[model samples]
Target: MLTSDQEIRELLTAARTVAVVGISDDPERDSYMVAEFLQRQGYRIIPVNPRLVNLNIQVLGEKPYATLRDVPEKIDIVDIFRRPETVMPVIEDAIAAGAGAVWMQLSIVNKEAAARAEAAGLKVVMNRCMAVEYRRLMPR
Candidate 1:
């Protein structure tokens, strides 16, 4: 079954940290916007992209990891920002990395990948924007 808004909100609220796959350095990208949004909401945002190796520490903080395997802390959620065809490997990596949930960004679709994660005991949320859910569910 596809994840509900309630489930996504619960996951986001409970998750202390999130690893963003396919994160881009370009400020115009949605990935960067979402990452910054989550960070402002008090979630630890770790950028997971191989292309960021050349970036400075102050810019990337902990230096972007090439994959989930390179992340230092336990990942609560793996927010994917890539194409549908590019998400399977990231999902597999999330499971291997011991992530609690897999969140595919808005407009992105990957049912097969979501099912695989669900089967692996990881909560899966697809085709949704986490930032939207957070605002809708936690609008104080």
Candidate 2:
């Protein structure tokens, strides 16, 4: 784990635009709730999911990208909601997309992938809920 609260706080403070990879169109999903909360907090939320491509849909008012490579702008953070085994490719994509950080949502952790992302110069936050951390670390 990246054991620096101050660092995490700083990261959260610096990040204004987040690409929510694996974000769901279903409003009841955790990914949706978290992304929604971030949007409400003034962050630009970019949803990414292959299903969106199939269905021609968007999430939370922003158009969904089929992949990180499909996004046309620089992403401050790549917030992952996929399973552990599916993370490596996403990490690689995040790196290729020039993202500043990779945030794995609650209960998701891939040490090897995290290492790779960190080695590639991107901050990694794993096994934590971004929304929870944001509420705890950032003052309103």
- lDDT of candidate 1 over 71-115, digit per residue (tens): 878999999999999999998999999999999998888889988
Per lDDT, the best of the predicted structures is: 2
Model 1 ranges off by over 4 Å? 54-60
lDDT of each: 0.85, 0.93
TM-score of each: 0.92, 0.97
In candidate 1, what residue range of length 10 has the lowest lDDT sum?
Answer: 53-62
lDDT assessment of candidate 1? 0.85
Clash counts for all predictions: 0, 0
Model 2 C-alpha lDDT per residue in residues 1-140, reported as the tens digit of each score? 45588988998999999999999999999999999999999999999998997898978999999999888999999999999999999999999999999999989989999999999999999999899999999988
lDDT of 1 at 117: 93
